[model samples]
Target: GLLGRYTPLDNGTDTVDEVALLELMKKTGYSMMQENGQRKYGPPPGWDGPPPPRGSEVFVGKIPRDMYEDELVPVFEKAGYIYTFRLMMEFSGENRGYAFVMYTKREMAQKAIHMLDNYEIRPGKYIGVCVSLDNCRLFVGSLPKDKNKEEIMEEMKKVTEGVVDVIVYPSATDKNRNRGFAFVEYESHKAAAMARRKLIPGNTLLWGLNIQVDWAEPEKDVDEETMQRVRVLYVRNLMLSTSEETLQEAFSCVRPGSVERVKKLTDYAFVHYRSRQDALDALRLMNGTLIDGALVTVSLAKPAAGRDGGGATWRHGGGGGGDGLFLFQRENGGVEGRRCTTPGPPGLLPAYGAQRVFPLPPGTPLSPSSLQALKPYQMSSYVSLLEHFCYQHSWSPPDYYLFSTPGPKILLIFKVVLVSTQNSYLPDKLCALVEDARELAAQHALWSLGTHTHTHTLGPRYAHTPTLTLWGQGTHTPAPTLELKFVQELSIILFD
Candidate 1:
């Protein structure tokens, strides 16, 4: 059998102490027998070596969570002459309770094992050792809430073989809930190798949960600024033949300049631009555009920084403040201009009787029934109803209304009428209208149900009213109220 030996100090004193060495061998699990004139001892034929180097390579059994290098080093040194020792610490300065110890000499290491193996450093705790390699495994985290053990196992199965075991950590307080982490073990090294090859970070599911894999070591907390500068772009729907160069060519036309580098990933390509602005421009212009007959989507190149200040500001449609205005000649022979503004009436309206009259229609006119119904309300009620109606439809009322008030009291009377009609039928009519609109939206799979209130009012009075009283007559029912609330709640479930 080959003797597994390690040299501690190259120039250290070497003298034979056969008797003590032989005795140590037997205690440490090595076999020994006297032959002719010399005594020879070797590891048992089937012994792998020190039961696989416990704390050094594989950490098993409970150890103090607060164990540290300074504390652990002395204990291991006393057990065996330590050559190298390290206790892994997290970036936040927390001890990982793991330490690696190397004996000054393999013989000394073996000697220490005889004296210390199965001997508790602390009561009831024994240490083990094994040969360690540099390769380390990491656990991926932040899985979706709805993801199950079976689904995760299926994903891992694609990369490895020999299903050994997979343990999903659950919330300590909630057994049925995941703590967003899991560990997988394989029967063979090859299986672990396969898993490492297949499971990568940023693998997304329909619910927007990302799958991440890492070595089973504590990670350094990255600086916020450092994270901001890095960006990841996940391009999808890419042409199969598209290479890094092809993607570079497609994004090369971005106005703010081209990508700094492009790389082809598993099924897509990652593009890094000189600046975030360049990346944003590329996303806006290149996304959904045909690239070799395939529609490619462009997104941020890396995980976005959690801090609000770092991301690139994306401007689309046009450049500069005045770019969006459209200038056209109107039928009245005057030049007219239009631009997107707050949903209300146009801010810079032409005079009521100007030559152009702006040509743009005023915000939707109140129906005759709506005006008549509001006849009994006070001016405050009218204002409240108008505000509610505007908000419910996501509309903004005109800045100025062309009202012909006969007197202050008459004006008040007219305002009251407007409020009554609006309050009575507006919510029911709006709900019906929204339902119709929602139906249309559903046809294209574009609608997500949302809710306002039964009567779209700003103050507390509106909140406490019977659902029926707000909508008036046939429209009054608890169904729409419950339906709206349910829709709001269901939206969370649907998206999640």
Candidate 2:
């Protein structure tokens, strides 16, 4: 419902509750999962070789909020030529204050840590250098509020001794409080598992409230085996502009319902399928495909260690980070291997909350990554999109105004007072204006930005028709305008 409010507020223009939405999911006999950690999933039995050598992947934290891959490369290039580096992204496609850089050599990574550690990348934002670990931390949910880190640490002492520290993310809404969850770090991945393992026997309480705990690494990706207890295809190198809905639509074309869910991150995402065969099919078809002109690398994801549900330790996107629901197929009144019912609608990810939408059937869980094709339009993303279009086309600010009509779905309306100006509306010029406007709109996600709705939906390849005829018909009649579609996190919509 807050998708409307999430609309961006421009110099003129247009962005939902996360808490209220989470409560709704909880009422549905389920809770959202945790952040999906990053990984290069290997084969079914898993990669036989040792993980990347330490210092091969350097963890750089506390990065400047606006720093992107281009800017990040030079900082680490001081160490050596980098193979690639991925900034930990928020669901909104913004940087999440950290990054992982893969160097051509491990020693170069160590050199980066030494040269950049504690270096102030931005005022108040310094580079926190470390090696990417296996995320030896647990996200404790349904936690009681008002307790400081010390008290939370005290609670962890009861569960295990290998405790390192407890960190509760400050509330996005309130500064004086936390968001009711905390990360319990351990000395080792084994100790972290020991603590989370105890919680699996049943629910555990941190402060009189039943709290669910899972591996709480927000900046990493979990293997596919960690996913459905199943098979999946991992997609990476996505343009920050790509929307989850568009990703789903592209993969769904691989085969109907062949793609189940997408776990979208800052720059990459995961596509889960129903079966191993389906996963392989998706990988084979979509490993290197173009979506909105961006090339994405899709490949079979590796499976995680553990049984499904109670024994499964790995998870990704929704409910919370790094956690997904347990799937069990009952075979002749007895449960067999990990399997969920055919997916219903897409569901929302608890971690990302309102930024990305995932609609699903009753009692089913959802996560980010892909949007269901053809998402409804809102004033939020359009606010920025509209501004961008106006800026690009040089629309007369006073003569052109954009607003939204609110109903079951938000209807975005763009109105321009088109006077008979042959100077601005020459044959070739008008064609360019219309084409450029359409191109801007086309850049929108099929899930976010919409296709033509008034006429027969005009896709990119559709033949040209008069997009604006009001000026030719009569200048005094209703102004001629067009509607564009876009799906993106509201944060990206903000003009301020």
Candidate 3:
């Protein structure tokens, strides 16, 4: 009577009788209604073969409500031999608008996704298709808090196949008890799927309680490409007053000089390392660790913007001088400036030198207006201002000036030794700024700026003294004007 009342092709007009439905399923090769109310048709009416291998299943969604297996199975058959077709159904005898189709081969399932995804099942009605994830873990909730891992594993083995391990978390409130849920890892997706089918609501109970069972969600937030074997760590959430030297000392605990450089920002920093393993170890050990009473987060540094191949090009807007901005290309450890329309101070011209240059740190503000704020005729005031600017930005004062050939246009060469409080390296930002201007000079034959390690027996010398030398061409204006232009160019390099 149920077979007569409800047929496989029947479209949701009548409810099928359970007795006749079972007889109909027997004849049509469909399994009995599952605990979740889904009807599974494996080896669909033809061959008695084992289930398809993994990776052969595709999740199909967006089925019309009235659609049934008679309509869905044929469309999927166009892909390949059907190994299993599971259509989830409601109690009202309607399909649940989504299904899983397993092909005899993985290639066929992939083909089904390409050909039938968005395939029209009805007018203006299409289905979405994709490969189903083969999850090997099942989440079992509402477990007895008294049950330990070993006891749960023992009980689970009595009801399911392939029970590899049971992971239970301890309760935060009470350490003596579990959190009432545990993840059961299975040997394969098939084992977990079968276990889930058996453990659905009203089918089986654990410890006389109906527990929730579902596939454990897989992790998707690992940024593999950006973090692949990176040696630089980007750290954030630092204390505002944290210094680069402090960061270097903290990060170099792995080994002496393990940390190559530490670029400290307001409340963040980038730590560079020579070895990838050292960076990984540091990230694992130092992330969320307290520094200056604040916990810092450390992760692999992503490649910054404007990086092309192995070089970087930084373009800035017109600086405070109203002079057009300069373009600096960083390649081969030198920053070469180009298209700088800012002319040298009045009566100063180009006498190029082919030397490499470096840029100052990003976001370092070197004010051109500071030099302009002073009167060129006031030598004492201008020199004091220069020393003050360097001191304010934690730089050593400019003390060494090598004057060459007294004339109306004197070649004034001055060197400022970059003072490192504790280490042999110069600040990378300063290196970039000086090198950029040096290369710009080389391009136009205007002036020269270069870095060198030198010792002065007559004065205090650093262990590794890297000096910024500006070789000025003959300028009619007082040397202060030329000095102002040098500072302005450096400002442009460090401004943006």
Candidate 4:
């Protein structure tokens, strides 16, 4: 499968299973293949007969990454006819970074290695080739207690190339079963080194254990308490298309032989390095490299919880008020997380009677002859000044709307809407604002006595202003209950 169930076919479906003969021609520089009657079906002159058997297989590294097997075949076919091709893949269907190519003859296999080895398939990227090693050695640990030498060697061989011998260390209590570790010998040093780098980190689970690997012939066996753990890198948001091989290659390019172990999970992975410095080197090169079409992020992992005071997480507060309203959040001396709310414009205030309105006198209607005696006030001018005052306290600008005063001496009733952008208001602070507004009105020589039966229509949207007459009967005595009520309504809307 080429990363997905379907192979990209030349037929134009971009499908799977069908090989990309054209891509092969372009990369390998040849197209002819002898078919049924000794006739070449392709355009160029090429090799004779079908591909060879499985025994003549060779491993190729650093494939022009993200290429499907069908396309990769041509890159190597330049050396010989492909018998069988296997690009090892991760469980998620991503290439493992290396592939095995079987050819028609031993000579052809050798030819491929020489011609394709270190070939720059793409800019700054080259292919590496290796013949299967016949004798090599490796260390394996975390084996099940019942595992035997033969079983361990067989298992390792299934994943690695060339294996001839194995040694198991048994527990003191029994010779029949091992103490969870063993040594494996391959056909050559090359094979041993390959296994050491690829398998030693032991993120791959085997026989139910995430087995560990190192040289059984160790440089030293220090006490467990004195051993320092390997530095690990945390990689996240891996695309399902990313292969273990691609990731490993990216990290290895940073520092050769630094990546010791890799364990991949649903959308993340962990890469262990031999040393912290080497891990940092790997991070520098691979922190944002794209693999399988997705950019991956890499960082050093923090120690697990309980290691260094259990890792505290802090979040920054949003500050003051936000969104459609503001909340005046504060922590009282003893009580915590208390908040206040600000009121909206008069007509916009909640169903409660926090808003007041007054109507113009019926006999004193608007006329050009009478206009000279009345003073005009800009809506925004006063509002801007009021906003400047409240903002210092972290509140939003108030909305002051003026409708004609009805049946009265020419007085404009401006509804002072001290809207809290943070959706909160302190009672003390709100009253202070009302007092300031009254003073400002008086200073402008447009002051009107506070009273009931006031009616006002600030704009065209409101056909008529609601009458407020309760204050005359002493039913609403609280100073600026309108402001407090507005704040209460805003708070309800905010918290709800």
TM-score of each: 0.22, 0.24, 0.32, 0.23
Model 2, residue 301: what's the lDDT? 52
Specify the highest-lDDT model's number.
3
In angstroms, the error of model 4 at 21 is 6.3
Candidate 4 structure quality by residue, lDDT tens digits, 246-360: 6677778756776775655434566666676787777787887775655567776543221221112111111111111111212331211111122333433233244334566
Q: Report the number of clashing residue pairs per model.
A: 29, 43, 19, 37
- lDDT (tens digit, per residue) of candidate 2 on 1-496: 2211232334422112345434544443222222332211111132245445434766666666555544555567788865555544445434566656767666677778669877877677666675554456776755566776788899889867799888664442343465466788888666776776676424555555555455553343333334444566667656667788988888776568876666565445666666667776677777777766665677655433345422222222222321122222244422222111111122311323455655677978656642222233422233234334444445421122122221113222222221111011111112122222222232331213133323222211111123334224544533211211111111112210
Q: How accurate is candidate 4 locally (lDDT)?
A: 0.46
TM-score, cand. 4: 0.23
**Whole-model lDDT per candidate:** 0.39, 0.46, 0.55, 0.46
Better of 3 and 4 by lDDT: 3
lDDT of 4 at 150: 81
Candidate with the larger TM-score of 1 and 3: 3
Candidate 3 residue spans exceeding 4 A from truth: 1-36, 45-48, 139-162, 165-183, 187-215, 219-496
Tens digits of lDDT, candidate 1, 63-95: 354343333544555655444443333333343
RMSD (Cα, Å) for all candidates, in order, is 28.9, 28.9, 26.5, 32.4
The residue-level lDDT of candidate 3 at 151 comes to 90
> What overall lDDT, based on C-alpha atoms, would model 2 receive against the true structure?
0.46
